[model samples]
Target: MITNLERFKREMEPARQLYTREIQDFSKKYDALGEMSMEEFPDIDTQDYIFSFEKVNGASEEELDEIYIEISNHMEEFSRTHGIEKFCQNARIWL
Candidate 1:
């Protein structure tokens, strides 16, 4: 089993072009409403959005696992610090 820290570290690496491609593919899946909605934007997912990381950039299962770990850590830190900007900068999973 992979530890949380290990997974987070992996996700923190630079986002490859493949990742962007996946995002684009995701965008195509939705109709005009989904594509035009404010939720479709942003590198991160928000409550209003239905962002998916399943194949973000065509990442493998291992990569997605790492991304999840990184997201979890970011949430934990942000919750404790209450610093959105700093947390966002620190939590950038796309490097």
Candidate 2:
């Protein structure tokens, strides 16, 4: 059976390609993953996604801040382990 999220997405954006990331291993639980609206017209192969306050849909400020903190931590860790290297492909964002 189709879930509400799946059904809403189908009706709202049938032709759009979506990429999802599971909320995992951030500094804290930060489990704010749900119903994020597409914030930009994607350049599908771009190295990173940019979420903006201007484009925010139903998400709260805390949820956005959680994302920022997790990304900041990831970047700090990445620079420590692998400085300025694009270790993974953009397609892994889909995984």
Candidate 3:
């Protein structure tokens, strides 16, 4: 029989791994965007953008814009205070 602590650890391990992976992926994307390399940026795959928007089907454009603005403001604050590295590090906490 698995001990309670062992069971809990096993359950939490996957969540932690997933969170770390997401954090790393977001950091990479953020860095890629910050480079402002036109060749690389706006580089988010169109299909991914489409899919993301589709996931939020029915969201008004204004509502989406507001959300984007809010996120941008938060990112700006993080960038100013902690820089990208720490901002991305803290993103996991929010995620």
Candidate 4:
């Protein structure tokens, strides 16, 4: 039987694709900045960039909250490790 988790995965596919494309585009633009080379940037693993929705549709609301909290934590860690402030500061005018 098709499960809710499976359904959620299917429903979220398009959004995932859009996010991937947008992130890649943003990364390219960020790389274009002459201040830092790609080597200087954090080596972001493909898995780290992916949002894990495993069993999410079947998860309880509390579990879902935990999942989002974990995601936010990871994002904050990535931002800190990769000097996101510098990027945001420089990109602020364009934004």
The per-model lDDT (C-alpha) reads: 0.38, 0.38, 0.36, 0.37
| Clashing residue pairs for model 1 | 18-57, 19-57
Q: Model 4: per-residue lDDT, tens digit, 9-76?
A: 45544544544343334333322222211111212211112322323225466655664554445444
- Model 4 Cα shift for residue 39 (angstroms): 22
Which candidate, 3 or 4, would have the higher lDDT against the true structure?
A: 4
Weakest lDDT window of 10 consecutive positions for candidate 3: 46-55
Listed in order, each prediction's TM-score against the native is 0.31, 0.31, 0.33, 0.34
Candidate 3 global TM-score: 0.33
Candidate 3 lDDT over residue span 1-95, tens digit each: 76654554454444434444443344343311221111101222211001011212355666656644654455445445543432233232211
RMSD to true structure for each model, in Å: 15.6, 12.2, 14.8, 18.4
**Number of the candidate with higher lDDT, 2 or 3:** 2
Q: How accurate is candidate 3 locally (lDDT)?
A: 0.36
lDDT digits (tens) for residues 1-95 of candidate 1: 86654454345323322333334454454232122211222233221122333243545566556655654564445435543332244432321
lDDT of 2 by residue, 1-95 (tens): 75654554344342223222321233234344433333433342332333222323455777666676665556445534543333222212211
- The ten-residue window of minimal lDDT in model 2 covers 86-95
Worst 10 residues of 1 by lDDT: 32-41
